[model samples]
Target: MENAFLNSLVVGAVLLGCAVFSALAGDPDALFDFIVPPGVMPANVSANNFTFRATKADFVAGKLIVQKISLAELPTLDGAGVSMATLMFPPSVADPVHFHQRASELLQVTSGSLFVSFIDSLGRRFDQKLFAGDAFLFPKGMLHYQINLDPKKPAHAVAVFGSSNPGIVLLGPTLFGSGLNVEVLHQSFNISKETIEKLVAANTPHPL
Candidate 1:
């Protein structure tokens, strides 16, 4: 009886440790095996299996299309701890400057070419030109943008994230369209109020 009690205590300690680690790492998938207690599969496992297909409705007319899969869409992926999306950029189109707060992204170009640029934490800029079958990595929380290089052909790429939910923030919309005080933006950007107003106005009706 004493041995059993000590073993139970050990197991409890291990579980507590795992819980703490999962919280710190932001990886709930790490606790999947322990939480599910073995032999019991999650209900959504079968239902969530799917194939991703991109169509006209998936894109924003002439710009880009992103088809994403995440934990919110498929709970079964909780064990996988990763999410992905496919991006389609029409010729001469560009994705706005953006960043992912919760995860880093790896983009693999499947067809055509892409011109990608990013700014590091120190405000240093890096640019790369990717061709078919090329890949690039964008560090988490860094500002980045992508432009389709081919004016006659569309480009296709797959982006994988380290976290289930990779939060995205578009720089222009978040800054100009977020309804923050116009004076603050003017001061922060070192631009005149008229310039700020024009920028805000341009970003209001249509966000790039």
Candidate 2:
């Protein structure tokens, strides 16, 4: 069982690395083009053509900051493509429910603790508490969230994604602030119009 899990992790990492590389190269459509037929020399590619820098940004909630690496900031990954980010969450803060449409994610906790949860395709939910040195995987397109379990200390984790442009859709913002027809939402959610309005109001510029 342990060996299988480790093998899966390795496979996931390789897939993510390839996806990130392709997306960064602005050739997402070429994701599977590397599988050349026999007797063909693979295209010669190298990571020496460009440079890369890690960039940092603060989340809107002010409780978290993420430092990221991608092709945009590091063009040198043209051949060997991958993307990564380091997330720092302050005490008692939560990373809201969201999903990456294009990439699976691997997270490694370096400090403190985190409570992670996700819902699978069958609507079954899985939850785990991760401490320092622990790792978690969020499969592509799965809805997942995390919370800092420590009230006095901060939590830190490193995240690796399969795609350079792994798109993120936050549940609350997408549902409440997307500017879709309120009546449509009311009908779809089976909720009153007034409740939809209230939810839209609460999510404005403050999803947490």
Residue pairs whose backbone atoms clash in candidate 2: 16-162, 20-164, 21-81, 52-74
Can you tell me which runs of candidate 1 are displaced by over 4 Å? Answer: 1-28, 34-61, 204-208
User: In order, what lDDT does every prediction score?
Assistant: 0.80, 0.77
Query: Model 2, residue 5: displacement in angstroms?
Result: 31
Which tens-of-lDDT digit does each residue in 1-208 have in candidate 2?
9999999999999999999876664324445523333333456433333334455555444477777675455544333335778899988888899997767889999999999988999999999999999999998899999999677888899998876666678988888987878999999999999999999987754232
The true-versus-predicted C-alpha distance at residue 103 of model 2, in Å, is: 0.5
Q: Over all chains combined, what TM-score does candidate 2 have?
A: 0.69
* Superposition TM-score, candidate 1 onto the true structure: 0.75
Candidate 1 local distance difference test against the native: 0.80
